[model samples]
Structure formats: structure tokens, C-alpha cells
Target: MLNALDNLTRLISFDSVSKNSNEPISDYVSSLLEELNFEVERTTYMDARGVLKCNLLACRRPLSSHPKLDETQSSSASDEETSPKNAPGGLAYFCHTDTVTADRWTGPGGDPFSAIVLDGRVYGRGACDMKGSLVAFLDAARKTPHEEQKLPLWIACTADEEVGFEGARFLTENSNAYTELVAADPVSIIGEPTMLHVIHAHKGICGMQIRSQGHAAHSSTDMGVNANVAMVPMLQTLLEIHNRCLTDEALRNDAFDPPTLTWNFGVSDGMKTVNIVPDHSNAWASMRTMPGVDGKDIIEQVKRRADELGLTFTLYSGGDPMHTDAEAPFIREFCELASTYIGPNSPEAVCYATDACAFGQLQHRVVCGPGSISQAHTTDEFIEIEQLETGIRFYEDTIRRWCC
Candidate 1:
């Protein structure tokens, strides 16, 4: 069997960028899991571009399938055992198998897929963004003790996470596999770049577009209500809303960075030329709100404001916030395990979003993994060899804690 670093090197060799077919990586991972005696299944789906993709679910049998523990002995009491089983419930590792485009990653190597190891770091497109954690999880699973425990263990590698989380959505909406796996209310750990910090909360996301309509006419004629002019009031209203959220106690969550609702009106479209009074004008904006703050409610507020200004509004995308209780048993256990390496720390809330928001809706979930978010999408992205080893130990410990 390939070592963790070797597995990671093989994984990086596959260009599983978002929107591209991840069949190769899926095949590679499925083959590995099958070799390890896991019941591996793939939830195949087509991306927006109609490219074939998949979400892999590999389940190892429960500890009960192994020899029973002695009356006064713990699960670790035995040194000889068999492969794991996919019994009922157990802890799950959820990670996106897709990475963002590597257009900007111009490392010393010729290409992002080289997986160059220099200065004790693996430099590649997906090294820090994700593939690192997936490699660690795979390695830990390879090292798992066959001793008896109460629950099983699952690994979920979903596709299109960078492209609207379509893979996760499919798993949630279409797969009975996930339903069965989480039937026992197992804990889910989303493998994103958190530098091993246990992230318990994250803001929700909602994206919208507001359009203003008017009759087209020559600009000099003054014969039509300029759509651009009409759009100004709507933009001002959204700014006002943004400012209000900054000070609104109801929307504030001190645990997250900035501790306030964030609004970004970064896209707009309007008249084609100065000579024309635009027949239509539009602005695209997005908001990130604290957990427990409904993004739909914020959308409704925006819609109401648009209505007041006689403008049309449309919500194109959105996702719920994730907030696992800091005191959750799984969370405490994970933090304790992580603290041994990174030092003691409390559960944190990140302003950025993740696929955890998708799984968090169904069960207890937390976002914690190796590497740094700072290098996630940057050019020359890399993950330290030390972090990889740390992640391997961390995941191995976590797997043993719940699935001895």
C-alpha cells in the first residue's frame, strides 16, 4: 500500500478541478478503500456542464464484527483483529474531492500537478485547499486498528464543492446512503483547511440581484426614466441595510471575525452606451450572516426594500450557516486530541463558509483539518510535511477514539 505522502502525490497528479470530471480520482480512491476491505460506493452525478462526477462513500465494518472484548478488557486489549465493517452508526469524515482552478499557481515546478516536495512542503494546487486532508484520512484509515468498538467509520469524498456544493447537495437530497450512515446521529468532520483549529460556527451565505426597469430613449431627450438612475436608490438602500446590519444586535455574533453581517455589492450591469437611457439595470450582491440568522429572512428584507424602491429582486444562491455546540461531546474530544499538538484552544467561528454547512444541517459537524487557509488558493500553494504528519496522527487518534 502507498504511504500517506505517496497517496497524496498520486492524488495531486489527477487534475480534479471543479467542473471537471473527477472519475480518475474517484477510481483511485475507491480502489484504495476496496483494497482496505471497505464497502465503497459512489454517488455519481453530472455537473452543470454535464460532466460526470461522483461522491464516494466508503464504510468500514463496526467493531462488533471483530472478536468480543473480555469482561474486564478494553477494545485495545487485543493485538490481533480483522478488517472493519460498515455496521450502523459511526463518526464520518467529509471532504470535497474537487479543488479550485489552478490557473495562478506558478510554483518553481513546471505545473500545479507536479506535487513538488521542497523545503519540507508539498507544493501543488490542492495541497492546502484540501487533497492534503483527504490523504491524511486515507492514511489513517489504512492504519486503523481492527479491534472492537461500538460504531463504524465512514469517509465521504464529494465533488463540486467549489462550484456551489452540488455534490453535497446531491448526497443530501438523493442518496439514502447518507441517511443510513447518519441514522445513529454520528458526528461529521468536514476536512477543510483550518490549521487544525476546531471550527464550530460559520456565517450563512445568500446571493441576489436587483434590477431596475425603464423605457429606452436617447439620453439627451429626457423622455424616459433612466434605469441607471432608478438603480441608484436601490443600491443606496442596500448600503443602508448593510450599515444597519453592522450595528444590529440581532445579527451580531461576537465569536466570528468582524462579528457582524457582511454585504458585498460587487457586480453590476447597466446601459450599453452613454447615448441611451437604459431599458434595464441590475446589481448582484451577496451577504454573509451569523449562524441562526436566516439568509432567507435577509433576502426577504432585501426584497421588501427593492419593492419599496419599485425594483425587482431575485435570489440566485444561498446556504445555511453551521454552528455546532462548543460543548458537543465529539467537539470536546476532537479539541482535546488537537490540543495535544497545537496547544489548548477554544472552538472558533470562521467568517468563511465550507461544505460543513451542507452536512451540518443533518448532524453534529465541525470544520477542522491540516494546512492554512492563507495558502489555500494562492499561487505556489503548499502544505508542510510536518502538518501532514500532524494531520495523520490527529485523524488516526480521532478514528480510534470513536471506532477502536
Candidate 2:
């Protein structure tokens, strides 16, 4: 079991930054899963610069080959009938292997590729944000009892989650075997650093870049519409839309803090020099909305505002909101099983986005995993050793209950 943590430490030691190469980490994970008798599939993306990013999916079927039972036999059949080959359903576990740039952190402990441990914490980039959760899932799968009744387990470790969920999107579109999905990101569980929570819902994300066009001219004459000046109204309109979202009851989720849609204008760029009126200006913004809110409506509202100002703009990416029933059978069962290992009150909602949206579109019941969201993307990111062990136990117990 501890060897899994060591594997995680080694995974973090490789710098799989979002923009840089992830092949090393991907290859390492692929080899590990293969050694465990999992059938592995690899996917790679080539950037414009020809740098290759990679993702790995590993699947394992139980050792038994049981015949499908007739309707009359269903009630009396053993759990082995649900094994991947004979069962009508399957489950998938997903995690992103990429981390944000190490440059964001400072001090001697900040290097993302260097694994350090102090005070019982394994410090490194990607340690807490996701690699921790990823490793926990792997360990759980590895340690799960090989019973005849267990369903098949699929583990997907992908790239580009930090920059975007490209890897997850690709896997979902390409794979057709899974019936349920779990995203092992850190944000799902938030309680006392113990593995006691399951997240059933999360906000959806849409990122947009709005560019305003203007004619360049000298500042002294003001002959041309300054692109920067044009952006002011755009920003104000966005703020109004953001404020309006706060008042929308449909966007609110009682499970989340603040329980409303969130929008942010994160970056703006226009003129290169102060003395000149810029010909073009652009601003990047993102919206995080609850399950029922239409991200397209909010985006159109912004576009309408931009059109009213006669500003030319383009949208980059848009993501839809996702949610699963809190009372879903699988959710309830997983929550109950998690409680057996980590105690009760093991459910919550998150404001961040995950591949859950994609899986939800396919009608899969999605849930968040156990880890600390706060530790993600921070310097010296780490997951408690105890949490990993607890997660392994929970997975093992859940598989045993469902399969046997």
C-alpha cells in the first residue's frame, strides 16, 4: 500500500506541466498499470510546436467469466454476474496528470519536480492538486479484492486538465464502455483533511475572450476610438451580468457556499505604449454556473452588450453545467460505503468544474473524490498520508460490496 505513495512521489517528481511534455509521466503510469495486468490504451496530442501530450486509460476485468442470468435468475444470481464481461454496466475512474507551471511558487520548497517530505507531508507540485487523488484511486484499485462478483474497473489518467479538460473530453468521446464516472480531483471532498466526503455536483465553466476593434491614432488628437476605451463598457456590461446572476434563484445551489453563478474578468491586454491609441484590445473572462443555468444565455448576454457597443468579439470555449441526483442509488450507496470507512456526512457540492459535465451528458452518475482542493496548485502541495490509506480502504470496501 505504501508503495503506491512512493509511486505518487515519483510521478510528482516528473514535471508534467500543462504546456510542457507529459509523455514521461504518462509512460510511467501506463507501465505501472500494465504490470498490474490492466489493458492499457494511450492517447497523445501534438501541439503546434510538435510537443506531444499524453493520456492513459487502463481497464481490468475480473477473473471470472459468468453467463448472463435469465430474468427469473436475476434475484438469485450472485454478484459475479455483474463483472465487466457479464454485467450490463461498468464504472470509470478519472484523474488528470498535469500540473500548473512550477514558476508560480517561490522559496526553496517551490520546485514542482522535486519531491520533498517534511512533517508527514509529501511536498511537490501536483502532489495535492491531483496526483495524490490519482494515486489513491490507483492504490484502491490495486488493493481491491479480486472477488468473482466484482464489476470491471477502468482507470483513466489524462493530460491537460490544468489548462483545459481536453484529455477527459477525448477519452469520453472515444470510449464507449463506461456507464458511471468519478473524477478524482481534490475539490470534491472538504472536511478535516480526512477522506469522508463525496461530491455529487459541480459548477460548469465557460471561458471567453472578447476583442474590441478600434482605429489607432495619437493620444493627443483622440481621432480614433481607443480599443482600451472601448473595453470599459464591455467590462461594465460583464459586471452587470455578473451581478444579475447573483440575484438569479435558479443558479443558486444550497449545497454550495454563496450558491450563485460566478464570473471573473481575469486578464486584459491592449496598447503597447501609453502615448498611442491601440487598434485592438482583448479581455479574457470565465463563468462558473450551477446545474440549471444556461451558460449560453449568459454568453449571449455579453455578446449582445458587445454588439450594442459595435465591438467585434469572438468566443474561445464554453462548457455546460452538470449535476447528479443527491439521492441517486449509486451515490447513496457510495456515500454509505464511504461512511463505513471514514464516517458519515460524506457528501457535498463544489463550485469548480470537472469532466463530470461530459460524463453527465452521457447519463453517467458522477461524483467527486476525497482530497483537499485547497492544496491543489499551491507550493509544497501535498495530501495527507492517512487520506490516501482511507481512500484505498473505501474503494476496496465499495468494490467488495458491489461485486460480492
Candidate 3:
């Protein structure tokens, strides 16, 4: 059987960047799932740039569909005990197939896609955040035969996660596996780089842009409407709001580190020369939304300020904050497993968002996996070899605990 490292090496070779089509990587994953006798659902969509992207949802035992019982699976357990009705839930693992841009890769090698093993680590883009985590789940799925699954074992690889989770949003409506996974209400995992630590909740993602338009003219003519000048009021308003987010206790929660919305925005102008007046300027901002906080309230405040300044305010995207009660049964049980395998551990809250935000229907979802968030998207991204083995074992144990 191929180990996680073996599989990750091949997977890292693919440049599944956010701006490019993920068909190639998705195809390879689809092939692997098929070879494992998994029932696969492939969903495709055209990105904003009209590039084709793909999402894959594969199950070892697809809900009420099971075939060809492995003798080993049956020998250890009775058929009655193996009935789907007896099994309360299965496991669902979520990962993104797309990675961030690797144009700045400056590791030992020039090729970011060419994965290398050095100093007991695997180096490459997405190695930790998280093709490595994905491969670990794949290894576990490979070991867990379909015939042995008393419940479903789901694996979802979404596209465009680096670019606002577009594929996850797409599959939330289009994929049958997503439909079934939601209906199953199984405990789901968003396999980001958590260093194998469980994450109970994470902040959501939201952004808006305020644009000011004006006519360009020579500076000497004084006939041009400088968009930058018109944006002054909005800039002041944003600064005020930004400070509130940073310091206002009422606008924050203690459950998350930094607790605040962590809102940030930047101003940009298209002006080229000092002699010419700028015709266009815009301010784009994003906030990491938290639960119990009305992020929209802040957004509306910004919008109203733009209206007062006679500027256009556009809310471009919003992914709801992912939260599951840390006291939930599934979480407690998972913690117990963590204690046994990875030592004493508690569910943590991360500042970053994951695909879980889009598939918010799965209330029991948690974000956890190998590698560290610090290593994610770094110029020399890598995962320690130790994490790969431990991640595989943890996933295998989780699969057996829930499915077998």
C-alpha cells in the first residue's frame, strides 16, 4: 500500500493554483478514489476567469449503497451489527485541491511543484496547507475497505479555496455527495494545517470595496475631479471603524484569539504621473467575521458612510464563521481519540477560515489536520515527515472508530 508521503509526492507535482483549472489534480484524485472502489461524484464549474474547476466527493460505502463484503470485514463482525441502521454516523473529510500562487517559491529548488524531501520534511507548495493532509486521508481511505464500512466514509476535495472558496460554495448546491453528507449529518473535518489539532470554530470571511470615480485632466488645468480627494471622507470613516474593531470589546469575542473582527482595508489609485490628475481610486477591505457578532452590522456602517461620501460601496463576498459547540458529543469523542494517539489535546479556535464556512449545513464540522498554519503559504512550505505518519494513523483510527 502506498503511504501518505508516497502519495503526497505525486500530488505536489501538480500546480493546482487558484487562477488555473483544477481538472488535472481532480482527475488524479478521482482515479485514486475509483481504484479504492469509492463511489465518486465530480462537480465542475467555470471560474470568474472562465477557467474550468472541479470538486470531488468520494465515499467508501455511499450511504445506503454497499457491495462485495470483504471477508475480513465480515469475519470480525456479524452482519446484523454491520447494518447501516446500527451505525449512527460516519466521517467526512474536507480539503481544497487548489493552492495559492507559487511564483515566489524560494526553497532549495526553483520548481515549487517539484516536491523534495529534506531534513525529514516534505517541501513544496500545498505540502502542509494541505495536500499532505489530503493524502493522509486518502491513505486511510485506502486502508479502510468499502466492504468493511458500517457507515459512510466521505472525502471532499474542493476547488478555489485560496480565492474565496468558490468551489465549496458551488458544490454546496450542485454535488450529490454534499447533499448526502448534509443529510447524513456526520461529523465533518476541514483538513487544513492545524498540526493535527482539532479546531471547534473559526472566523468567517467577508470583503467590500468602495470606489470613487472622477474625470482625469492635467494638474495645471485644475479641471479634473481627483477621485483620491473625494475618497478622503471614506478613508477617515474606515480608520475610525478599524480602530473600533481593534479595541472595542463589544465588537469582539473572547473565544477567538485577538477576538476582534480584524478588519483591514487598503486604498489604491490608477494615477501614473505627477502631472496628471487621478481619475479612479478605490478602497478594498476584508474582515474575519466571528460568531455572536453581527459582521453585517459593521458592513452596513461602512456602506452608509460611503453613501454619505457619495461613493459606491460593494459587498463582494461573505463566508459565514464556522462554529460547532466544543462540548458536542462528536467533539468530546474526537478529543478522547486525540488523547490516545496524539496525547492530551483540546479543540482550538483558529483565526483563519476554511471550506467549512461554505458547507455550513454540517453543524458538527471541525477543522483539523497535519502541518502548521505558520508553514502554510510560506515561500518554503513544507510538512515534517513525522506529521505525515501520525496524520495517517489518526485518520485511520478515526475512520475505524466511526465507520467500521
- Among these predictions, the greatest TM-score belongs to 3
CA lDDT of each candidate? 0.79, 0.65, 0.84
Order of candidate numbers by TM-score, starting with the best? 3, 1, 2
Error in Å for residue 275 of model 3: 1.1
lDDT of 2: 0.65
Cα lDDT, model 1, residue 318: 56
**Candidate 2 weakest ten by summed lDDT:** 183-192
lDDT of 1: 0.79
Question: Least lDDT summed over 10 consecutive residues: which range in candidate 1?
Answer: 70-79
TM-score of each: 0.87, 0.84, 0.93
Query: Which candidate gets the maximum lDDT versus the true structure?
Result: 3
lDDT of 3 by residue, 1-404 (tens): 46678789889999998988999999998988888877889999999889999999987784455443332322221113345443335788999999999999997677899999999999998899889999998898887766777767788999999999899999998987777677666668888988778899999989999999988899999799999988988888889989889888888989999899998999999666898889989998899988888577888898998888889999976689988888766787788887766789998898899888898777668888988899999999999988988888889888988887
Q: How do the candidates rank by lDDT, highest first? A: 3, 1, 2
lDDT of 2 at 227: 71
Residue 30 accuracy (lDDT) in model 2: 83
Cα RMSD for predicted model 1: 5.7
lDDT of 2 by residue, 1-404 (tens): 34867887898888888888889888888887876667787777775467888778776666673423233311211223243333323455677887888886652465667777767677788777677777776776677655544455667787777666776676666643331223211112211122447777777788777787788778789597777777898888888877877786766667777687777774455456777778888877787867666567878887888788877767754456666667655567767877776567655777777655555444334554556777766655777777666766775665555444
